[model samples]
Target chain A: MPERSLARYPQAVTDWRDFSDDGLTPTLRAARGLFARNGYHATSIRAVAEAAGLSVPGLYHHHRSKQAILGALVDATMDRMLAHTRAAEADSDGTALGRFDNVLECLLRFHMLRRDDAFVASTEMRSMDDTLLLRHIAQRDEQQRMIADIIAQGVADGTFRCGHVDDGARAAASLCVAVAGWYDPTGVLTADEVVARQLDIARRIAGFPPPP
Target chain B: MPERSLARYPQAVTDWRDFSDDGLTPTLRAARGLFARNGYHATSIRAVAEAAGLSVPGLYHHHRSKQAILGALVDATMDRMLAHTRAAEADSDGTALGRFDNVLECLLRFHMLRRDDAFVASTEMRSMDDTLLLRHIAQRDEQQRMIADIIAQGVADGTFRCGHVDDGARAAASLCVAVAGWYDPTGVLTADEVVARQLDIARRIAGFPPPP
Candidate 1:
């Protein structure tokens, strides 16, 4: 990992402004907010600099371009999401369905907490140059494939039944990701409630019967 | 309905240019493609006119502003989708689950056919003025309610076993709408196949048992 990525871990940094001490620069955070709100194509480097309280030249000192900021955000988000999936599996009770539920719950909670970055990552794919888009998409597909593999394994072991494993997996993944687009943290449902509700939907999609 | 919209019905127009004859105009078609491809904010009136094979003055004669074009596109797409839902219900055999299946299959096929328009309608909601956005969202919510009501009826009838009717409805609707965002018509799956598979997933999401 790059030295700049150190601040992204949050636990590593006591102060958010200490880019030298920890790498979560204001410029990175501003870029993410602008891209998430106004969209990547509409946001300019000047806007990001102003939001970050830096001169254009000062901003360039830390990051090369707007694309670089977007690339970093996308990479970090995918990395974190994939890590959550693996962690969920490792902590699971060793059944495919249990692993599936754990992974779905992890994804639901992750998307809720990182909703803004998740929105930018999903909606701004077209704004990225081809190579960066492909790189990020590969990370996303790897996450999807992990879910797909679990569904396939469940089918093989008679733990799950569905019309098609791949379709079931995609539907399951899509349902979870869609939560980030519409979920409101301040809304009536608590985060735990949202996760629990979505896990139920995911289980149904995977052809697992509801618990009695 | 306007006379120009008649050509949009397909059976009424033998020649493609009948839209011109009826004053439906080529400008509308050009705007949809440009907005869907380049995005709403990035696409300008000059670009839309050029793509329509018209001078700027000519394009303005058809559409006074870009917002009008986008408004028309969003309104028409929502109207068509709602129509499909109602028609599916009207033609259904009257069981709640059968009505549910018909509506899901109809939505899947309509989304696949109008994928580009659907894309623009969804992603460009932010670019619309607040009043227009609310108007379109009302239509979208109405469509969601249709599915929600169906699930509610099914659950009350003991035909479905969902945890929560509203969340299940939202998840089912989101999964179907998302099909437009990623579907490739020229890819391995045909439209019928996509509809059939999505129907199966919808069934599971509704907490119905798979077909024997």
Candidate 2:
């Protein structure tokens, strides 16, 4: 797949620091908050419009339906996630382990720092239509494959000793994704600490050798 | 905390085989399906009554409100999960590693086989009121403590070498919980295979020694 920039995706924001009201349009900001809190099935277009401080017609002028808003939010989240993963890979030292560590760290940071988006993207996919679901699933699959491929390379190059590369990849990815569900911003551990701990866990999950 | 039996929790059921409509009351069965599919806020008491072939008042006779049904579902899920974890520990070989493997396996199976209940319990917690939320949070914390305590035991006994016991416990639990989000019943890997793979991954995460 061709690498797409954040500019190509209107809803895509930079990072947790970039997750301000300034980054989102009024419609998207309101919809994201409502959808994240109340869920898509329970949230109505009028409520989103009201929250965004616009009339229903005004909201419709930019986004036709609640589904559109959801799709936009999900799409934007995937776009930002994929961008981070790719950038991590691109900035790596060209070693499989290097790429693996960088990508995994990027994923952990994204899920923890941008947890609301991550939670909505992970949980509300069931509310998406078939086409929208397929689009996001493809993006998700691509991300999964990225991790799996890196693991495969590591195994081939003797950097990783995992017996089941695909399973190891899945377990590693699942561990990072799971952070979004439980990570507390106000908790004792800072985001960096959580990421560091997860990186250690991921390395072990991938069968990386201990330090000599 | 005192251990509770399935009999004490009316909504609790056995493993995947016991997930038939026969195990659930008509009201709960209907509500579970609707809540899993459409989410708690989107589902209505009338719809649940209609699906269960009961009148509005009759549904009320069984379930007082939509929130009540959601509470019952989440409570049942937690009850069943705790039961499985305790049972696995009881059935272990009286070793920390043995208990860890068994508990992780039980959790993986529960999440994959009873995915709808798992999904509902996970995603609908946001819709729960504070009291219900605290109750379930306590149950969830108990489960987390189970894994962490086992890991701590393993570390103390030199069976595990993880540097961060608490984070290791969290990662191990999170990896198993994530199976509910993506495990496809019709997929190639059976539930047992997934469980075995996760156990291997968990052992690695706990830093158990390789064969000498």
Candidate 3:
């Protein structure tokens, strides 16, 4: 197995501190919680306003409607995910295996660390209007392509012997995205343990050689 | 790879015909659609009754409340999944690899073929009350254990080389369950193709030897 120097990256690239809810506006933060607990269609603007300590009119000043809030949240989540993906790629050792390991670890960590954002962005996609949906889907496709490209490169170089690059990439990404659905902060495994285990499973799926 | 005679099982065991909405009552069928599209928290009893073409009183005769409908839907989906799992196990060649392959294929096919039920059972889980949630969790845990046991047996018998059986099982199951979230009947891949690809991916995740 190839190894990269973790010291080359900034501390935020390897730490969970940057994944907190600090970047979100108060209204978006409150709406994220409400949308996560209650479905978007069931959560009213009044409820979001109350949760965020704003009047309904004041909330409307920031977000035009509930749909707008949902769009903003999903967009923001995807943006952060894309940024982390790029950072992980940049920190890799310029090998397909190294990029695969780093990117998969980054995704699993993001999904588990930002559990609520991931959950809402996944489940509430149906609530977005067609325009927003298309844009979000494009962003998601870019992330999927990142994994597919790595696997393709690996397969070409004989680093990964997987027969099906597209399906293998989909499976790798899908498994990591699922961490948000079942990860428990209070559970037996820490986020690091889960990420490490899943990274191994992903490598195996890609047909990477086991460590000697 | 070990082979099993799928022919030994009844026709329903290997067919998608059994996974249709034929088993649901009219009201439950309507509610399944409503919950899948708008979500459980947003759907009401009146909406379900109207969609089912039943009077409020008539709908009440069958189900006590909206939660009852959701409970019944989730319960029935789990029952079917468990039944299929047992059937797949029975039909296996009595080897760890065989059981893992059959069960993983069965799970992927069910999630894709019965997409709506799987979607509702997964996303609306938070809407179920304490008792219902516990019951549902037990059923889900049973499914998880089925995969874990197979991987553990394989590891012990030298059929699989994967370390961390528990996490491997979770990743295998999680990747299959995620099929329902993204599968499209009208998309490029057919259900058969998707299941075949996902089975290959699951086998790799479990450290099964690649085909020669």
lDDT of 3 at A132: 90
Which tens-of-lDDT digit does each residue in A1-212 have in candidate 3? 01111111223445432465435667778888998888999999999999999899888777778988888788778877877888888888989999999889988888888888888988888888998999889988899999999999998988888788888888888887888888888998877777788888899989888323
Q: Chain A TM-score for each candidate, in the given order? A: 0.87, 0.88, 0.89
Model 1 Cα lDDT, one tens digit per residue, B1-212: 24225324333223311112322346777888877666777788999889889899876765668897888778767776776677777777888898899788877776777777777887787789987899998998999899998988888888887768889889988888789867897989887788889988898888886223
TM-score of each: 0.86, 0.90, 0.90
Residue B49 CA error for candidate 3 (Å)?
A: 0.8
Q: Per-residue alpha-carbon lDDT of model 2 for A16-73, expressed as tens digits?
A: 3233332355677678888889888999999999998989998777776788888877
lDDT of 3 at B150: 96
**Per-residue lDDT for B139 in model 1?**
90
**What value does the lDDT take at residue B133 in candidate 2?**
93
Model 3 CA deviation exceeding 4 Å by range: A1-17, A210-212, B1-17, B210-212
- Give the poorly placed runs of model 1, Cα more than 4 Å off: A1-24, A210-212, B1-25, B210-212
Error of 2 at A34 (Å): 0.8
Per-residue error at A89 for model 3, in Å? Answer: 1.1
Ranking by DockQ: 2, 3, 1
